[model samples]
Target: MERKTLITSTRNLAQLFATLEVKEASPQYSLDLAWPNSHNISVSIKRDDLLHPIISGNKWRKLKYSLAQILGSRTLHIVSFGGGFSNHLHALGFCCHRLNIRFTAIVRGDYSANPSPMLHDLQMWQTDIQYVNKITYQQRESPAYLTLLHQQYPNALIIPEGGSNKLALQGVAEIISELDQHYDYIIAPVASGGTLAGLIKATAHSATHILGIAALKGQGYLEEHVQALLPQTYQHWGICHDYHFGGYAKRSNELVDFCNDFYHQTRIEIEPIYSGKLMYAVKDLINRNYFNKGSRLLILHTGGLQGSRAIGQRASIL
Candidate 1:
């Protein structure tokens, strides 16, 4: 009887993934920068931002397998931790709503006073938005706190803050198969380290070097998170800590100006939080002649454009 039920759940989840209408592969476009490339290096962007308006880019990739596993299990309720304007929560809320699964977003800080655009969407999606203090939220990954949550919601599947798990790595690694050709270096913005770790896993045996441009201030902290998710040791990947600007979601005038100019030059929309910092780092590296003369670089445009709506006028390029 249990086996029969499991088979049915697996079929249902597969059908749901099929009906999700997500783009199987995002297109890559050559970047035409206004500045000249003195090193004769070429840069192309894998437009994963075009994956979906909401569940786009790394968000979709990171959550795809997790959602599949959740649906195959007896658990129908999902509990996750994130900030009020988190793209992970926003995408997960939409997916859960579409699948008719119960979702509870354990958001950090009291956004009830001034809810973000993401929180508003969560409400519309019928998600249980639970705002907790920073101190309590800090215990999100603690075994004791997770045990407490397991006790509270026995039928719930608890996803970590950014949905960075082994399942997420599997989905993220799929990006490598979708690529038409290989490049010397593959670069992406690092947040929870899942995306970078995924790229690392995909190119683990390959000669391609993976570079993660940090969007936040964490140096050793982010590396530790990436290492935890990786199955084995890999020296082909490294994280750059210079382009964080001012930590996660924090923006600067210089960064904003660069994003705006980039839009005018290439017409590719980027937010200051993630993609902006990524492009900025790439350009800075290029100007500093970081890449060899014949090196080709592939930039992963991990989409979180929806979260930009929360910042409103801050993302003037959007």
Candidate 2:
């Protein structure tokens, strides 16, 4: 089953809405391990602490449960799809390097003459990069899409565009197990919707509200993605509606300045993509009294700070 019990502090406030409390089962989904096979090499950060360069948050979360299914018998060639400035790609590049695995990336959009600095750095990591038209790129989540990809590159361990899948979900859901079970809501950005969907699926109907902030503009389709993973019982979710500061990868100097100010205040680092939006909404909701004053809030840090390295490259160049 997907791990549980751990709750980030932002979740604490969400529990106050629990008309009733309950325990739910979010069993393990798929698995595909790709990491150090060196037996007896124990590390200090029991939680996927691959060298800091290899990464910290989403890398471990996306890999943990996926590794179990691989059975650890091969020199995995890790491959995934992403955009030019993708943090998932960055994490995959670094993680694959540390795990002694080959890495490949299928990125969407035309290649810029000077791509985001993050994309530039991944090249130095020796991750092979391929570009595809956006139409085919958007089809990445489909099983058929993956099958077609395998026909072309049959020997790679495939991760979806965002490292998004039931397996990656299982990995992230495991983070909940590390926290105290006293949260009212858990919020994350709605990207491919896998992370938010997995969270709600794992939490089930535990009375804890799962609120996903849509960084993508006009993301009503995320509701469709959530429905794909959850039962009708999850009809009572509290996914928030207004946080996109334009659209994915779109931002303003206001947000940039806000992030700097927010970091000074909370000592918490939230990337403009996910946690930053959550932080903005969380504070707003608290002020409007949607959240109880004394309630606790657990804002998940889905970790995409790497995208910030190339701030000058975003399209929302306001």
Candidate 3:
């Protein structure tokens, strides 16, 4: 009976993933910047955002292998941590609901009075939402708390915050295989470092350089996280730390204006959190003549459009 249930659960999980329709390769297009550039630098964006409406961009890549492993192991429950406007939790909750897998989102703060759009979705999906204060949330990786969580939900597969793990790197690395052409620099927003790490791992052997635009202020620690995920040392990748604006999820008026202007000019929507900062950094780099003359750049648009809705913007623009 247990084996039969496991087979059924795996089959359902497989079918749910199939329904996501994550393409083998997402669309890529050039960005015609309105500003002048003396250097012959060209920029293009890989629209990973179009991977799905909900399970979009790098979130889908990061979770792909992890969910497969969990389901293959017959684990029917998932526990993970995230902030109020987390794309990770939002995507996870939707997938778990589709697979009939129990999900618990250990949210980092009390939002009972005013829940974010993501929190509302979690409620709609019937996710077990547990609000914890910042201090307790900091102990998420502590062995003591993990042990306690194991005792509480023995059957649940506990994923780390941002789903940055070995399996996630594997999924992110696959992005390289789908690309039809080579780029001088392949760029993506760096938060927990998994997505950038995956790019680094993927192109470690190639001449293509992986550039991560840091969306937050953790310069030193973010490098450490990426290094830790790497199997060995590789110097083909680097990060740009100056474009974070204020900090994670904290955007300045300048950043917001840039995003709006970018959307208006290119008809490509970007939020201030990740893609906006990345595009901003590219613009700055080009203006400052950072890239070599005639160099080509490819930016990965890791989608978190739902976050735009959280800030009361049109979800389409995020």
Candidate 4:
């Protein structure tokens, strides 16, 4: 897909967002995993990672409508929060750069001295970086702090950490329409629960069941987070918090090995932070006979390959 030229005109910006072009279709490929249980289950992956080069996977979906709102309004600056290796900030910075808008990233922890590959990419995209202590970072969502931020940067649109908002949910809901065939299960990685919330909302009345593998430790609060985004009660979805490996952004030798093996087998790159853990959970569940025989499963490959750079020795463990 051709990149849209940057424009300052409201009409042109509206048109650009209205007709934003992403890769028409991301190819889905069948995956073969050695399951411990004797059951007839088929697995396939929706390669949302191929949606775009930078704004890939669920990040693009989350940002689609958020950017539209920013451009449609008089907001000239976009402010958001993330960690050192945040794909959310990386994608948001790239989008802001392409759209000719200013992006300010409030980074968690004092990572200004040592930058990761994701942070470097954000810098390359001309994102204004601000380092904050953990204490201040925790106040990111406080009403007083948000009010202060608005006062500091007038006309700036503050996107929640991970871009998990109502607009983001709307964009993620569109992912369901991209699937050509129906499956019994739809599984995705859950961080802040925006993508899973969107999927649950889209499949609330369908026969398909939505499973969210939490990517963070103690993510039971994700149920409430997802419920807040959805308009009505959704009972077709459940979350599994056992696959985080260690915790958010934490990796292990086993995870690295799995990621390497998965890439070698499927020719698809997966970062340990999200997609790797998701595949790990899917395989573990399959082994434990979690799915009925003859069940078809669809896994969402929400991209974060850029984060693989920070894996250090673990990336070479395989």
Candidate 5:
């Protein structure tokens, strides 16, 4: 059950306004939103015309700045990992076609005959989908796990899951270039920590505080994940290990009910994986008076809404 944000105000001062005009490299789309009081958080859906295109919002933001680094050959077989029905996979497939590049998506689960709508889109994008067992999928970042993939596909440009790596951080960090210094807080859900890490690192030593709502369960290891980009220096900022509904892709009835209540109140949909937990955490923090009332908090609505299908099946999709 997803509801969009109500754009009630005359104008929002906090949202990072995007170029809605489609261009040569990418097209533009906006997040249907209910503008927040502090600052409206939004992302542009860059509609790329080819395979491996970033169908997900900010997928373009995460990829735009890294194309040069990734441009080695005219035809490159790109590899990335995600669940059986990953938006990342779908986007990567479409994007690859656009660039005329060969693409491979190392998925976490067995190929489902009847996959989620998003996964079907990946197939439509002609993603060469490979399956890994659940246990092995859990260890994707481990050296041995990478070794296995490398042994099989040695030359593939394997992007880390959630696109959370140093290169990805470079892409995400470029977001602040268009922003002003008025925002007091920044909020985004922590997945593999690439986006969160980018935001925090970009704002390091600045007055603006960054908060990440964990969208996976038992993210105690996420600190190690984010810091993997930087070594041991800024460990304190990667402080979200809870609030992930349950691990990476699990949710409960309570969270579903919460999403419904949230929709009723705000008229905005919060996917079970990400924005749902973020809203839950942010509301709690607000009730506790976590920040100054007048200070602006920019909640980045990173679009992973594709995952909503599976959760919706469980929640009885509306």
Candidate 6:
């Protein structure tokens, strides 16, 4: 799609708002699995993965309020940061295209010579892509770099990397209201910590235990980041750093095999980067008898099926 083909009328913005307003909450399904222990434990999954084809799961949740702010403003462009296979940029590009706003991505590292599947999708959406070295990318959070970006795109709304902001947290917190019943445990995959932070804030007064399965290595820093996002200190949540398998975007044969077996049993496709690690941790914890009898677990499938293509290619080569 080209910029010329984008519809930039207020009518279109109104229609888009209406489209988002009427979207039904994603469904949650109970899973029937035989546990080794004799405890009466129930497991369920929230199908945020089926929320949308391109802009699915927490990606949509994180972007919903930001997109609304952009639509309400006079800014004609959107700017953000991401890596080669960032689902954040992928979803942002498509959202900008649909909203008739210009989109630019400050991509980490140089991937123009060999674009990943996500980069290809961004280009298809006509997102202006800019490459920056790792050293410069690290300066993304600095005021100097942010000022420079604002100078480049004068009337642009700049979103932080991973779309983790107050507005994004508000969007993720809505997941709490969509639940039909209370769960003893709420589990989700954690990368940049936005989703987990939202869950912690939402369940602050409840007895529910929020669990974050880290998807990257060296996740000790995630606690600080998540704490910085919240209004107050919360003690009802914990993060598991053991399920990453290797690191961000890194997969092992065990994770791949587990994903295949999970798909065969549940009929729900999961990629290794996010949902696979979450499901793996759930099963592992269950076998270890981490939960008591009659405990209910709710797993959030935060969607990243787009990354599965890369996993499939890697598996074939191995």
Give per-residue lDDT, candidate 3, residue 50: 89
Q: What range of 10 consecutive residues in model 6 has the weakest lDDT sum?
A: 4-13
Which candidate achieves the best lDDT against the true structure?
A: 1
All candidates' lDDT scores? 0.88, 0.61, 0.88, 0.84, 0.62, 0.85
- Model 1 reaches what TM-score against the true structure? 0.94
Predicted candidate 2 versus true structure: per-residue lDDT over 1-318, tens digit per residue: 223223422242233112112112122111121212312121111112222433445554665444333324353777788888887788777656555567888889867577777678778888888888989898887889889888877776787767667777776676567654556666667777777766777777476777787877755677887676554557546567687888887766776666666666544455677656766665566556675444445666566666766664223322
For candidate 5, what is the TM-score? 0.76
Two-way TM-score contest, 3 vs 5, winner: 3
Please say which candidate is ahead in lDDT: 3 or 5. 3
Off by over 4 Å in 6: 1-14, 17-22, 313-318
Cα-based RMSD of the predictions, in order? 2.4, 13.1, 3.4, 4.3, 9.9, 5.3
TM-score to true structure, per model: 0.94, 0.75, 0.93, 0.91, 0.76, 0.91
RMSD of 2: 13.1
Residues 138-240, model 3: lDDT tens digits: 9998999999999999979999899998889988988899887889999999999899989998898799999999999998989998999999999998888
Stretches of candidate 2 above 4 Å error? Answer: 1-54, 142-144, 231-233, 312-318
What tens-digit string does per-residue lDDT give for candidate 4 at 1-318?
Answer: 223333444455365444455674577877776656625798989999988888779998888777876666777899999988888998898888878899999999877778988888888989999999899999998999999999998989999998999888888888888888898999999997889989998887799999999998866588888888889987899999998877887878888788888777767788788998999899899988899999999999998777667766335533
Better of 2 and 3 by TM-score: 3
TM-score of 3: 0.93
| Model 4 ranges with Cα > 4 A deviation | 1-21, 37-39
